[model samples]
Target: MTAELEARIELAQAVERGASVLSSRVVEAFLNVPRHPFVPAFYRRDGAKYVPTRGHNDAWLRAVYADDVLVTEVGGVHVEDAPDCGVTGVATSSSTAPGLMAEMLDALDVRPADRVWEIGTGTGYNAALLCHLAGAATVTTVDRTARLVDAAQGRLHEVGFAPAVLRADGAGTPPAGGPFDRIIATCAVRRVPTAWLEQCVTGGVIVAPIGNALGGGAVVHLTKLPDGGGGGGGGGDGPIH
Candidate 1:
């Protein structure tokens, strides 16, 4: 294999070895999904290297595999697009970095046959991973951008994985296929959306980033109370362990 490819493999392996600290399902998803495919050519031109706007490139690649989060885009623009400007577009969405995703999954504690609702389905990478764990038929993802929704849906289909993907604002609860066992938001929210709480099943989990400012990347893990109408909130801090 090429050096970059080899390095990526090693990175993935490292993440797998650390799975004891991560959710088993999340680790499996990282090993199964190819980050290279989702990364843009600008940052990934060197194969496995994750060259950021500034900083040590090698350190970034390792971070990608670790349980830490990586910002693939700023605003609506891919980081590679205008690295020098450091300007953010609108903060669309991303497949939460491998490390953060693991913690989120660990917090959710999804089980087989669990029906999942994934909001802000950016590239569909996260949805694909969830499907791999919960079964594609049990996963449904939504995005506000039609382009994003279509692209994610197409990618899932191309990979022979089928998950319900739709173009809709994630501000409200998903109507069909919910009363979900788990709900994950790939984007950020300032306040808990009552609609989301309303649709989650009793004892279900809702994992999302509760913030509006950049760099406020804390992942919030909420478990629905027995009534399925309320939740207790906690900041997720399970390291890239």
Candidate 2:
């Protein structure tokens, strides 16, 4: 078997063991959507500096599918732009661990045609999974960073998915769109946004990490009710790290 496929299969097994119970569809999505395409390069901390890792070698491919968070941006600079000697900064964005991603996606309960709105487009890996679960045309993902949005859009398009990728604040109102069937946030928020609630259709699901959920290290999966109340269920505490 090819190295990528082998690594991904191993990752799938690890995710099933470490994260929440995944459905057949979720498993298929994990196996089908290769993580390396979305994260062309990532940072690995070497002492105080963050070194960039990029290549198509065996070790590189293994790390990409290792169920680990790949830090793509550090202090607003993409890893690809960093020097060989590396840079020192706080990680601004990353391709989250596959286990955490699987857990959240399983909680999202995406259907074939469900209209999905994703809060953080990060490496666009999660967005690609959403496209695999739902349809590409049914997904809309937004991120505040312009460069990240552009990179994500290009990577996603390269992989044959063309969801609506926007460079807008996830917490703010975008141009009239959605009464969406599902909304998922890959980023941490202090509280669930009122705009997100308003945009979701009644009975729609919102899977997000908010407030002490992360301190408790968990994600909340809420269903919108006709009365505009949410019926929440807790997903596994699969931390991004």
Candidate 3:
């Protein structure tokens, strides 16, 4: 096998071993989904500036397979569109680390026929993984930034998975897709959006990272109760253990 593929397999196995109870489907998705295509170029913070991976060289490939978050956009500028000198600003979007993704997917407990609505499309990696678990037709991902959404759509298509990728605000009303069986957000939200609750079917699952003013965060796994309210528990300041 090629070195890159070997590295990817090792990374997937490491993630699987680290998880307490990751489903087999989740493990397969992690092993097969190509993370490099989704994040063609990412930034490495060098002091005040962000440095882009020069090319798809050995270093870039190693970083792609690493169990680490990759910053793809900073200060509204995507790494692919940034100047050669690099950009300076807060990171606006990123590819979530594989370990965290596996935890959230485990919490979601996605089934084969489940219809999932993903809030943040970012690199499209998570959406692709969802498509792998739940058929592509049942997966829909939305992002507020048109550029990011468009790029993600193209990348997903390149990977032969074409789920519904839309450009809309995830915090607002859910997309016109309909009541979904699962709703997940890669971005941090201050509170669970009521629209998300309203869009999810009874007994559906919603997994998201909720942020607090104290700079702490938690991954909340809420189930839509019969009364259309959320009920469940959450893990604080770390991956759901």
Candidate 4:
């Protein structure tokens, strides 16, 4: 096998070990999904600027296989579009850390027949994993940015996944595919959207990172109840992370 492929496998195994992801399905998804294609270019902070990887070589391969989060966009400027010197601004989006992603997916507890709605189609990486766990036809992913949605759709297709990728406000309108058996948000939200609760089947799981005003957050796993209320582990108040 190529060294890069070996590195990716090792990284997946390391993430599984570090995150304690017990589900074989989750582990297999992590091992199989190619993270590099989703993040063709990412920013590496250098001083006050965010520099893009020089080229897709060994260094880039090493970075992609790493378990760390890679910033794919800064201030709405995608890394591929940024100047050589790099862009400076808040990170508007990123590929979440592999360990954290595995944790959240484990919490999601996806099943083969489960229909899933993923909110934050950043790199299409998480959505790809969801497609691996469930079937691609059973997964629907949405993002607010049209550019991101378009790019993610193409990349997902390249990876033999063609889940329903849409450009819409995930917290607002419910996509036609629901009521989903599982709903996951890669982005943070201050409050759980009522639409999510409405779109999810009763007893379905909603896993997301919830932040608080204290600058702290935790990944929460909530279950939709028969009365339309949500109850699960962890509690915090802030935007979804």
RMSD (Cα, Å) of candidate 2?
A: 2.2
Displacement of the residue 155 alpha carbon in candidate 1, Å: 1.6
The lDDT for every candidate, in the order shown, is: 0.66, 0.83, 0.85, 0.84
lDDT by residue (tens digit), candidate 1, 94-130? 4455656666777778787799998777767677778
Q: Is candidate 2 or candidate 3 better by lDDT?
A: 3
RMSD to native, candidate 1: 5.6
- Give stretches of model 3 more than 4 Å off: 212-216, 236-241
What is the clash count for each candidate, in the order shown?
A: 5, 1, 0, 8
* Sequence-dependent TM-score of model 1: 0.75
lDDT of 2 by residue, 1-241 (tens): 9878888888878888885457889888988887888877889989999999988998889889997778887887889888888989788777778887887888889999999999888888889999999999999999888888898899899889999999899888842459899999888777778888889999999988764432235688889989887888775553232
User: Candidate 4 at 182: error in angstroms?
Assistant: 0.2
Question: What lDDT tens digits, residue by residue, belong to model 4 across residues 1-241?
Answer: 9876798798889778886336878888988988888888899999999988757798888888887878888888988789998989887778867877777788899999699999988889999999999999999999998888999999999999999999989878799988999999888877688899999899999987776322237667899999998999964322221
Residues 1-241 of candidate 3: C-alpha lDDT, one tens digit per residue: 9877887798889789878888888889988888888888889999999988758888889998888878887888988998888989887777767888898998899999799999888888999999999989989999898888899899999989999999989887678777999999878788899999999999999998888422249889999999989999898443211
TM-score of each: 0.75, 0.93, 0.94, 0.94
Q: Which of 1 and 3 is ahead in lDDT?
A: 3
Q: How far does residue 218 in candidate 2 sit from its true spot (Å)?
A: 3.5
- Which portions of model 4 show Cα errors greater than 4 Å? 212-216, 235-241
The candidate scoring highest on lDDT is: 3
Q: After superposition, how far is residue 192 of candidate 4 from its true place, in Å?
A: 0.8
